[model samples]
Target: MDFEKLIVWQRSKCLAVDVYRKFARCGDLGFKDQITRSALSVPSNIAEGMERYSDKEKVRFLWIAKASCGELRTQIIIAREIAYIAEPLAEKWITDTRELSKMLCGLINKISD
Candidate 1:
């Protein structure tokens, strides 16, 4: 599979961009920075893992990316608590994370298969 051409990567890149733009105006620099980092990690790790020559390594990194997704999921909830975005937008982020997680799982299974 051309991992670089994966739709998940494309959506993740978009999610990272959305995250940066969403937090860009926030006064809470510390929280914003951490959230952005977590958001960016999702796609970056996926791409990095996919580029590896080994399925074991790729799956390992995908697991790591899945963990990062969990962290981002938590951060998004907290952000919603602090009113970082509206209910609908925060819910959308949650949904996106869930979908991305599923996609990662599917990729890992494909590697295993």
Candidate 2:
């Protein structure tokens, strides 16, 4: 199946775009770059894994993507604590990451089967 057609990939892609848009006007370049990169990694890895020839490779990439979601969630919490992000926005981002991570786990299971 095409990665683009996968709901998890689509959700992750949208989350990455939302993260980029939300951080567009922020002044903290270091934090912004880190968070955006982590956010982008989720969907990028998903796509890369989906294109792989073996299920093992695909699972590996999905695990990476899942880890990226955790990284992104941690960054969001730090951003919120440092006042770089609003509480409500951070909460939403954290929720998104949680859901995305769970979806990644489900996908990984399906591929590993």
Candidate 3:
């Protein structure tokens, strides 16, 4: 299966790009770096997982991607609380992360079975 064809991968890639753009000028280097890395992990792991030769390896990477989604969501909440992100945009990102998590879960289950 092509990871690029997966909706979860596509959405995660977009989310990572959005995160990078959103924090392009952020003064908080630590927070920006952490969040962006977490965001990038989702899609990267998914691609790596799908390209693996075995189901076990694929599932492992998908799990990592799912974990990254959770990490990214936590960072989004923190960013909002710190006022580094505006309410509306933060809410949208939070929602996007949640949806991405769900999509990842679905893909994981499908692949696991």
lDDT of 2 by residue, 1-113 (tens): 89999999999999999999989988889988999999999999999999999999999999999999999999999999999889999999899999999999999999998
Could you give candidate 3's per-residue lDDT for residues 22-104 as a string of tens digits? 99999989999999999999999999999999988999999999999999999999999999999999999899989988998
Clashes of each: 0, 0, 0
Model 3 poorest 10 in a row by lDDT: 103-112
Candidate 1 accuracy as lDDT: 0.91
List candidate 3 stretches off by more than 4 Å: none
**TM-score for all predictions?**
0.96, 0.97, 0.97
Cα lDDT tens digits for candidate 1, 1-113: 67669988888888989999999999998999999999999999999999999999999999998899999999999999988888998999999999999999998999988
Q: lDDT (CA) for every model shown?
A: 0.91, 0.96, 0.94
Report the number of the highest-lDDT candidate: 2
Q: How close is candidate 3 to the true structure, as a TM-score?
A: 0.97
Range of the 10 consecutive residues with the lowest summed lDDT in candidate 1: 1-10
